[model samples]
Target: MNAGHQTTRRLAAGAGKSICRSCRDSLSRNYASAAAAAVQTEDHVSQHIPPVAQASPQTSYQVNAGVVLSRPPQITRDLHPFESAFFLYQRRLNERSALPFTRYFYYKERTPADREWKRKIKQRLTPARDIGRYKGYGEEAWNDEVLVGAKESDFNWQVERLLEDAETTGVEDQPAQELTETTPSPLAQKKVEHEAVERPMSRITEADKKNDVKSLNRLLQRTLYFLVKNKEGQWMFPQDGLQKETLKEAAHRVLEYSAGVNMNTWIVGNVPIGHYQLDYPTSRKTESGLNELGLKTFFMKARIMAGQANLKENQFGLQDFQWLAKEEVKTQVEDKYWRSIKNMLAER
Candidate 1:
């Protein structure tokens, strides 16, 4: 019975081992098939797909230096008449104090209609009957004389009237010579002259020399306009009271001391466009430190003549010099100041 049992056990064990070996073989084959299929799929994909081309690092650096790095051209435009007038007047005025001032004229560019109109009217306009009257003067000469001589004469007349008024009580009254039989002392004469000068209504008369009158008149009439820049990149024309210097002296110093220009080379005209008043608040200390509401400023026009402005170190902290046209000035300057500038330009 024991021997039979052993035979049965052996047979059972052998069968179990064979079954296990078969299962192992099937698993190995399935794994091998799956790996082969995956390899095939990868190979097929790689053959069908194109390789991506990488961008070259060198191409981006191929910028043309000549084309991209050239300097920009300068932009400029024709100067306005005021600028030219300033130049001319400055040069002339510097040479002589009393200049025969005349309005500068420019030839208007005629349109097609204007040309046709002039052509039609040309034949109808008769030549002057009295040629002898215009014998010494051609059209150009006549125009020059009418503009220059007439203006000079008018200026002289105005100056004479002003001077006459300074000495006499009124035009209707007796002449100053008749009124005062005794010759006045030199000191009294000087006192009268000083009084007349201080009084705005007092006329500067013919008794005053042309140079003195011109200088004094310029001191009264001329305004010194200067452009200043601040740290924040804003622009302004700075002006202050005539602290110490005379008008002509101040004008020269404004260029020399403030603007740092070579005043010896640069010239300026005596005839200014006009004057305008500005008011502002101030701080005062009478009994106690207090804020005052009383400060006044008079701005007058001064035109540049010959040399360019060579800026210097100034208290106003100006960065650059500029000539703004009326239109540009109107946009940048304050309303009250712009109005003054506009009026001055209009006088041109």
Candidate 2:
């Protein structure tokens, strides 16, 4: 009975081992078939694949460097009406709160200078507190001038007229013309003449008056830019194609080549301040002998410190030029071009 049981156990163990071996063989065959199918699919795809197409003449945008040359404000801006009134009020307030004139310190006691100063002050100026107390306004009022007084309600005149009426009579303020008996001494007269007033030049220039757009002297208080009309009769900033140089170097060349080498301009930096991508259908040929589909323009900032543009050479094939303010530039150029460079201009 024991021998029979051992034989039965051996047979069962052999059958289980044979079954495990068959399952392993089937898995290996399935994996091998799948790999072969994948290889065949890859070969079919490779046979059907198309050749890579080459780039045409206009594979990309043509790199261009544009210069935004500007003349900064030459003078301070004019004060608006409200600004003027505010400044006037501030000056008056300061004058009102100021310390009284130290007569003894500024002038000697009872000397000719002191006597002249006293006479002048009494002749010209009247105290605001002492005004209207008496009808007489002293000797300051002239025969032809109207009699003036500061009133409590201030109804005799508006602020536009008779402002600070008691401050100065604006008469006989000049040094005595003749060196007669009542005139100041020779030394005093000489001193007065020595400190004679000098009038300042007007802010408005002849260029502004004549509306000369070429002159740099116009628009003293606003930034003025350089614009030129191209052969197409469109106004734009001076620009040129890049070649074997950095963006800033290209800008300097553009300014010199287009605007002329006479200008004393300094580019602000190596990096561009603004960029404009234009789809310009250009007939101009590139080094590749192919037409450029468009231009990728990078704008660099430059300031004109001294000299002006020399458009006489016409090296850039320009039609006309102008030095105009930002608003004027917007009016001259196309709307799309204006939108691209609008923020690059100085607000002042």
Candidate 3:
């Protein structure tokens, strides 16, 4: 009976070992299958991911979201006319200020027809004929005269009149000067002679010259406009301001200054990226904020022209002040950049 019991126990132990071996094999197969499936998933992700260029639209959308939030439509619209006038006036004023007396005199000596045309322009706000209809003057020349001659007061008066007429008539009526074709009167000739006589007998003082240059410069700078295109690509100017010539100089100065500082890459092709990665991070802390670096630079340039070195330096944190204060990093950078520009211009 003892020998039979031992045989049965041995058979039972052998069967138990075989069952354990089969269970271990099944577990190993399941783990291998799971690892293989995970690798396949990883490979699929690597193959399907978009390249940088292809994802540009998404990137653009992200960047523009910030711009849309910070910039109001009215701000852009209001600045356009001011910037255009600023640049236009600056150029003309600079040219006039730089010329020899004889050359300037020759330029002012218009022919009989030219005087008549100018009289017609002064008599009416509306230009009756197309710019091309004028014999000697092209679009550029005509625009220059109209801009330079029409001061801020003149524009204000014209706009006021237009608004008044619009309110009264329920529509704006075109000025009648466009329909009138009057020859230059004797009074116009006499006025021209009087202006010629009033021309400075000696070279203008430095201060006066600087003032004239600044006036025109400011006008041109103020005239710059920002426009947006709709889906159809039609651009509309929405701002109103003085247009001056100095704005071009300011823009050139900015580009040149930026290039000198090894910032040309930022200015040219990669503004959105640079703004996101570099500028946006710093913009959140201040009142004027981070996006105003370009505008700050423009203002600094204007201040320099205005002969307000102390104020200009203060804006850049170059001015020494008592006590502790949080200094703007960009102001410091721009201050250094502009100093380098001044040095370079001096060398030239």
lDDT digits (tens) for residues 1-348 of candidate 1: 333344445555777656565565565566666667888999999999989999643321111100000011112323464554444344333323322322122223354444323332233221111111122235543322223333323433435544543443221232456324322445224323222544334333342334332121322222323344544565555443455654444445544544555423322344333454543334343333444334343333444443444556655456664443335446666687566546544211
Cα error of candidate 1 at position 272, Å: 6.4
**lDDT digits (tens) for residues 75-194 of candidate 3:** 222335666566545545554454334433544556654544454444333232211112233455434344344543243444444443323321122233422333234432332221
Number of the top lDDT candidate: 2
Comparing 2 and 3 on lDDT, the stronger one: 2
Q: Give the residue spans of candidate 3 off by over 4 A.
A: 1-316, 320-348
Better of 1 and 2 by TM-score: 2
Q: Kindly list the per-residue Cα lDDT of model 2 for residues 311-339, writing each as its tens digit.
A: 77867788889999998999999988899
| Model 1: CA > 4 A from native | 1-226, 230-234, 263-273, 281-294, 346-348
lDDT order of candidates, top first: 2, 1, 3
Best by TM-score: 2
Q: How close is each model in CA RMSD to the real structure?
A: 26.3, 11.1, 22.2
